[model samples]
Target: MSKINLKKILTYGLVVFFIVGAVGNLIGPEKILEDYARWGYPNGFHLVTGSFELLAAILIFKSSTRFIGSLLASCIMFSAILTLSYHAEYSHAFIPLIVFMLLLVSIYLHKQKKLL
Candidate 1:
């Protein structure tokens, strides 16, 4: 596939991932609630996370705001990695770490596009 197609696919994938994450957090499933509690976050903290995720998704869906969306995603993933590491959840941290790297790539791609 062309580079443009690859970039578009990646962008769409990230958007969908964030949207799913937002919906899951907003739904506040029992496991998610338990996780927040375990992480020392107060109840309903999921709402805050969900809101941010939703915002990120929206920003990412717009080419003009994609960089900001990636930045927001990077921040969220960084926090997740730190929290998991502090709590000795290395396995859990891996996913966030991967996402963090993906966000970095997204930012790099955005910058490259800006310069071209």
Candidate 2:
């Protein structure tokens, strides 16, 4: 068996991330609300976060909006990291932080000056 190409793997990873996360938000923003509650955020924050996640998912699928979407997502994930870190929930939040970093790298690679 051959190793998967890094770029292909990253691309698929991003697609899965956005699609699954968007569906989760669209179907049950309540889960996000629960997470916010765990982090002690106000009730209304879940709606805002869910909305952004949905929009970001759409943007990420489009070539024109990928950069903006990735940038906004970077902000959102970093905020989550900081909030969870403050509450000492690093164990649970670490995966999201790593995913965000991969998203950032994917965005950089996709937008390479010479390529796009």
Candidate 3:
């Protein structure tokens, strides 16, 4: 497959991932609420995070706004990593770190004009 096709696949994949995450946050699953409580965040904070994720996912689909979307996504992942690490939840931190790396890759590809 061509490089552009790869980029499109990655971009769309990230968008879908963020959208699903947003839905999960908005839906306020019990485990998710428990995690937030354990992390010392207010119960309502999940809604804020979910809103940002939903917004970022929408912006990521547009070439002109993809950079901003990636930046927002990266920041969110970074925050998760920091929080998880601070709480000594190293195992949980792994996934956020991976997500952060993916966001970086998306940013790099966008800069290279491979993705929107």
Best by TM-score: 1
Q: What range of 10 consecutive residues in model 2 has the weakest lDDT sum?
A: 22-31
Could you tell me the lDDT of residue 70 within candidate 2? 77
User: For residues 4-59, could you state the per-residue lDDT of candidate 2 as single tens digits?
Assistant: 78865775666677667656655666667687788887767665776777777677
- Model 1: per-residue lDDT, tens digit, 1-116? 64568778878988998999999999999999999999999989999999999999999899999999999998998999999999999999998898899889999999999999
- Deviating ranges (above 4 Å) for candidate 2: 1-9, 25-32, 113-116
Ranking of all candidate structures by their lDDT, best first = 1, 3, 2
Cα RMSD of predicted structure 1 = 1.5
Ranking by TM-score: 1, 3, 2
Top model number, lDDT: 1
Residue 4 of model 3, lDDT score: 67
lDDT of 1: 0.93
Q: Which TM-score value belongs to model 3?
A: 0.91
